[model samples]
Target: MDWDREARTGLPEAVFCAGKTPAQIDAILAEARAAGRRVLLTRLDPARRDALAAKEGLDYDAASATAILGGPAPARPGRIAIVTGGLADLPAATEALRTLAFCGFAGELVADVGVAGLWRLLERIDAIREVDVVIAVAGMEGAIFSVLAGLVTAPIIALPVSFGSGVSAGGRLALDAALGSCAPGLVAVNIDNGFGAAQAAIRMLSPRGGTAQNAGPS
Candidate 1:
């Protein structure tokens, strides 16, 4: 089924189900199970996940719209810090947490830290700095990336969540803010790409199966 992606990339292929039909998703799941491989499906609807989970060895997290086959990885070192700008960003933040759990890393969630009330973030700065890498999830201009970069020495992985309408809507502005930030240690993933962000952190933290304590920023 051409699932050799894991062999080449050192990461498993994830099934993105936004446009795929149920039968297609089922076929892919079957193939992965047959090969004894672990798989992740993103953008899956709740009803579909509930229906599939009934008979398959799948566990679903509706908040993240993600489903996992095969058990999670064994626990490892290097914690991940997931910071969300607002409540609207929880879904994506949860996605990063679930992905980090699957990847065998512990993750901490710092919620509702939008720029509008910078105090929320400042209060949690000490906790956030304790992690190996930070996944900053935000919408509406994504100032969290630059702010965190300025304060912490950890590597910041920006995840821009898309919502709202018109020009600054759908996370374009947020994505731009992260990419265009003058901060020294900021990195970025696509809009709502929590899974990708998690993978990046995992690789950075566990390069060659070793802790990244001295691997430099993130």
Candidate 2:
């Protein structure tokens, strides 16, 4: 664990569980409990989640592939929005949602609103605009980020997911398009990094003026 991460950086420590063994994850969880620290474990598999569920104080969300130790912070209205291009994008969207939940922020989801059917997204324009920040999750061309940027004044956090298919090449094109977007108030995070997107939104909505100097909520 990064002891100074919360105080110095204003972010909690999280475990990446994709490559770690069950025993290793358990050890980390034990450490977190021992230190009275809240931790999030990302990319966790269902088997591991189930196995660890027996442990005291561990909650797991299968859709997001995330597990929480020491309970999530209480959720409050934070005026955050999460929109996805298609159903295939829900996995990524779920990750952001779980992260937001852990940080005590509430968010709404606008699903299956890809640019191909612009009308779907157009229908939700007014609702999306009411939020302080928008998280656009897409995988194919990642055009949603730029499109949303042109419409909403709220800052957009572009989150790209990997399709693992031809040409798309695990979301490289989407990532590239998001980074090169011409629209204002659009920021891009790493491909499939839903947690990163959530953290960015939390910072943007932070009353502390979006600087690490102001520590986040406990």
Candidate with the greatest TM-score versus the true structure: 2
Model 1 clash pairs are none
Candidate 2 residue-wise lDDT at 37 = 83
Query: TM-scores, in order shown?
Result: 0.88, 0.90
After superposition of all CA atoms, the RMSD between model 1 and the true structure is: 5.0
List, residue by residue over 1-218, the lDDT tens digit for candidate 2: 67556565556668989988888888888877788888888999898776663467778788889878777786655788999999998888999988888888877999999999999999999999999899999998899999999998898999999964687779998999899999976899999999999988887776554324555544
What lDDT does the true structure give each of the candidates? 0.83, 0.85
Worst 10 residues of 1 by lDDT: 209-218
Off by over 4 Å in 1: 50-54, 208-218
Q: Write the per-residue lDDT of candidate 1 for residues 11-55, one digit (tens) a residue.
A: 557888888777788888888878898887888987666556333
